[model samples]
Target: MSGLDETLLDDTEATVRVRFVVNGRKVACEVAPRETLVDCLRNELELTGTHAGCEMGACGACLVQLDGRAVHSCLMYAVQADGARIDTIEGLTESGVIADLQAEFHRRNALQCGFCTPGMLVNAHELLSQVAEPNREEIRDALSGNYCRCTGYEAIVDAIDAVAKARCEGGGAT
Candidate 1:
């Protein structure tokens, strides 16, 4: 083998210790160099709400809020989350924001099979946090990343619009 090939084979694999705030709790975990954030959330922390669909960052099933921004967990390395604040779907109910969304989803029949609800809720929550009264276009744009095969998006849009209207009218969604 060439010297360069030999050196490449000898390269060491490092285990990184990452510390981050997840789901309102501080957590520390040792992860491999290539371990994705979704793996840590589901495998290590057992937070299964963050699903893995495409594993290519396309389905948005692994969506989570990283530092208050909606990010695809499958697209991020666990080590990259070190010292960052991460919020999964599980964290949403603690504040009732997600619960409200979930309730609205149910009322509007926005979910079926239940696989995409978590990601959808996380994305919707992030949108509502920034724009409490987003219009139909804005809601559609915000949820464009998430894919739900069960609902044709009409119900989902209705659910989001209902939430926005409730929030704007000085009323709680749930």
Candidate 2:
């Protein structure tokens, strides 16, 4: 109906019913048995913020937080996420927990094409949450799984470090 393509929703063969909480909302959908979490989010729920880069999980574009831990959605099947709480870029952005990080990223020009921003942010959120003040090597190690073709990662490292420092100093990019 309208501008939405119906065929995308009609292909339900060899599908399994999956129920999970996404972005604080409970979502239940029928997905193909081999459907990946990234595919389900992008195709079924339309949460395209989780990019599908290097679907084999080498690239971190399809990163999402599963039960507060960052995981590559491309590597996990949608069915595997059943009964789990999932959070994507949309959820983090809406919760305002990453506002400061986003601002720092923008100010530091950490993002170029923006494909890896979501995953980077998700991973950064995890890192910052765990380590109040991570060193340069720690930050780099945390983001090592995420591959950024553009920007050479210097700016991204700077942005995460800046946010961590500001937060520790009682003020940040928020």
Candidate 3:
């Protein structure tokens, strides 16, 4: 191993305490300096809905709402989010903020294995939050970062579009 690698390895066992508001609850935990947020959320916080796929952030399976914006948890260290507000799929589901979207996705059968569903839902929630009504192309573009191996993405896009239309018709109630 290189000299710097060896030096850094000595601190692998070290832990840092971090506090954050997760899913409308205050939480604090000790984690290693290099521990990714995905690992902390899944292991320490037990928020398994945030998958750890593609730790390098290429896959959006680890997507979560950090400070009200969609972020790849796999790309962020737990310590970096010490004071942020994080919302996982579990939180969103419990709050029923995305109920319509979830219903549409289920009705359209937009998922198969369900591994990528959480991230897709988080991304979709974020998209709809910013753009009340997004076209199919816009929905597809927003979902470009999230990869779904089970479905062809056609159903997912259709679901999002339907939700957008429904929301608009419902007097912009999201």
Judged by lDDT against the true structure, how good is candidate 2?
0.94
Candidate 1 achieves a global lDDT of 0.88
Highest-scoring model, lDDT: 2
TM-score ranking from best candidate downward = 2, 3, 1
Give the per-residue lDDT digits (tens) of candidate 2, residues 75-132: 9899999999999999999999999999999998999999999999999999999999
Count of residue pairs whose backbone atoms collide, per candidate: 0, 0, 0
Question: How many clashes would you count in candidate 1?
Answer: 0
Give one digit per residue, the lDDT tens place, for model 3 in 62-100.
999999999999998999999999999999999999988
Show the colliding residue pairs in model 1. none
How much lDDT does each candidate structure score? 0.88, 0.94, 0.91
Better of 1 and 3 by TM-score: 3
lDDT of 1 by residue, 59-79 (tens): 888999999999999998998
lDDT order, best first, reads 2, 3, 1
Q: Candidate 1, residue 155: CA error in Å?
A: 0.6
Better of 2 and 3 by lDDT: 2
Stretches off by above 4 angstroms in model 2 are: 1-13
- Candidate 3: Cα lDDT at 54: 80
TM-scores of the candidates are: 0.90, 0.91, 0.91
Worst 10 residues of 2 by lDDT: 5-14
